[model samples]
Target: MTRSPGAGLHLHLDPLGGAAGDMFVAAMLDAFPELEPRVMADVIAILPPEAGQAELSRGQSGGLAVRRFALLPNRRGEEAKPRGHQHEHDHGHGHGHHHHATTYHALRTRIETAPLSQGTAAAAAAILHHIALAEAHVHDMPLDEVHFHELADWDALMDVTAAGSICAALEGATWSLTPLPLGGGLVRTAHGALPVPTPATARILQGYEWHDDGIGGERVTPTGAAILAHVTGGTAGTRRGGRLRAVGMGAGTRDLDDRPNILRVTAFAASSGAGADRIVQLACDLDDMTGEEIAAAADALRAHPGVADLVLVSLLGKKGRPATRMELMVYPAAEAAVAAAIFDLTSSLGLRRTELDRLILPRSATISVEGIRVKRADRPSGATAKAESDDLVHAPTLRARRQLAHRTETG
Candidate 1:
């Protein structure tokens, strides 16, 4: 049987050892091994000129083997050496980088210049933006003034970018995350000692549920928190239920006594009775369009054969300019056509699209008053029936149609 467009993909994350950029990326790769070439290539292609190659391998934690990611940069210690050589760095920093620390501004520029797909680049920048914001606030400095320092290293950068690329790889899947584990005791930071979860990590993880598992050490790092904050939109899932499609275990560098330092990623398929379906929203900011122009565009789109619906909202776009954001939804099969139509109808050269799971009422049908035999859907007091609205041209009156519908329902 054919399925409707609403049947979409859902992703659930189990950050057992708390989420970090590498763990998140590694876990996702573990879940979808086929993505290694495509995902990793983009990371390598877009990295700063100074970065080396990225290496993903299997590692064990708490006796469980999991996917571990590291950056094997081109530069080396005194001499260029083979990959997998352990270098000096802190816990938050992944693998090792021989490059100098970059400022938040320079990092942002580097990401923008990278030749990445639309989705991957935006996601990468967004994850970094969270880190930058948190760091700026923690130091009470301007955003541009904030130096990435530990966060700017190749491993951290790769982790951050890989996290974004992972999200891009899971393009059509809705993302949901479990609450992070807040490890007990103090954690060492570049500045000094701080409570577990680290202040910057805590700041970026606002709105997410957290609980310390009574273990001693730092579970969530700023890089991890920033990735979660950006990827999950700062919201953690209370519960997600569906048929499992895939699962990946990402191993953290260190080992834990009780729990495996692994992040588990699971994919779920869309199901019925929950009123949930897969959805993709395409939006573009229209700063130059007049009210009439916007309305005309909407009218044209609403009439498109593939478009499901559209909404024009007033908002502030780049540089505080007044803009109208035109958001539209369509069936998965219609996505490409709809995007092409938007380009022809508006001034937007590019549009943003996000795949999501949307809950809709459990019902079915069609309606057409002009048809010789129209089809309409009606649920009266828990009972469902296909109703035919009044047709003065064909039917005698409204009451007569209801009587006919009642007889059909009773039968």
Candidate 2:
């Protein structure tokens, strides 16, 4: 079914609840059965032969029927080796696995050439590109030289690509999420055993609020964390006013006793009557301009490129000096241009900028004549009218002039 105009989607990342890319995708499939065939095929195609043994199926959790993607160890070939099971090997100064560096350029090309939907493929490539750029910056390597290990694996590729596909499918809608649940503990990887919520995952979760449930396991994967970071723009909070329609639960490979190991995806229809809001506010103080200059500056600012709306307010500053405070509502993208105008036009040494949410309404003009008000929804083309009451009152009438002339002649 097509989503209505004002709809939005809310996704809650339950890290303590086992956050894996496969788990999330399985849950999404269970929630939207129509997408199962496509998503399943895409996911399985990307998995290596050994990893493909794991089966994804529908199941129940917390009385809710959800998709469970269980990772079953392969019994043949290299899979014969214990998969995901910890083994003690004390030959060195600590427990760590050898991490192989996977070139970013190679990964990018592979993702771009993958057989997937256009939107999904693009998103997947974008996420990889972002990761590569970040990694390059951190390691002081060229973007092309940066290498990813676990992040470039088949499972990770599937997860990142699948998440991107899902997001692409839900475009044109706002996505809000709850504070991510980042479970605590050490995680085993090819690079050795690292603390749970790996370094990559931690870096992605920066600037966003997260809570630790002390589960001591690798609940959140780098792929899953990257997906959440890319989708929500790093903002987290509960949303209101949107009608909740469908809820999907994605179950992770491991089961938790304290809570359901699932990610929740809630589809919502935003309130149609709700108005649009602003994203930023730009304000500056100018205590050094004359009245005429201030007026001219206000006009110039209004005409300034990128200034949405300008308002000048008179106020008292320090030492009782009168001043004009200029407030400009600017598009977040245009803050720079508007600020430059303020600096050039007036002697104000500083300007304050803030982000705000404001609502606007539609309006029309009206005019009044002879005590009667007339509403004008639109401007009339080339139409003008003028009225003078005193001139009309003093003018002589034709009938009075004729009577006076006859009376005077007869006398």
TM-score for each predicted model, relative to the true structure: 0.61, 0.60
> Compared with the true structure, what per-residue lDDT tens digits does model 2 show for residues 80-146?
1233433111010112232223577776666566677645665566566556655666568787887
Give candidate 1 regions above 4 Å deviation: 1-7, 48-50, 73-90, 93-98, 272-411
State each model's CA lDDT, in order.
0.66, 0.56
Give me the candidate number with maximum TM-score: 1
RMSD for each of the candidates: 19.4, 21.1
Candidate 2: clashing residue pairs, number: 8
Compose the digit string of candidate 1's lDDT tens values, residues 1-411: 122222345677888877777788888898888878877777876665555678899878788778888776565553222244332112453223335447877777777677765456666776787777788898999988987755645667777777767765553344567667877776554566667666678788865666667766767778888767654544453235577878889877776778888888887665543445676789999999888988998999876645657998899989999999999987565679789989998999899999877865333222111211222122222324344444333557778666666553332
**Candidate 1: residue 371 lDDT (0-100):** 19
- Residue ranges of candidate 2 with Cα displaced over 4 Å: 1-18, 44-54, 60-64, 70-101, 272-411
TM-score of 2: 0.60
Error of 1 at 2 (Å): 19
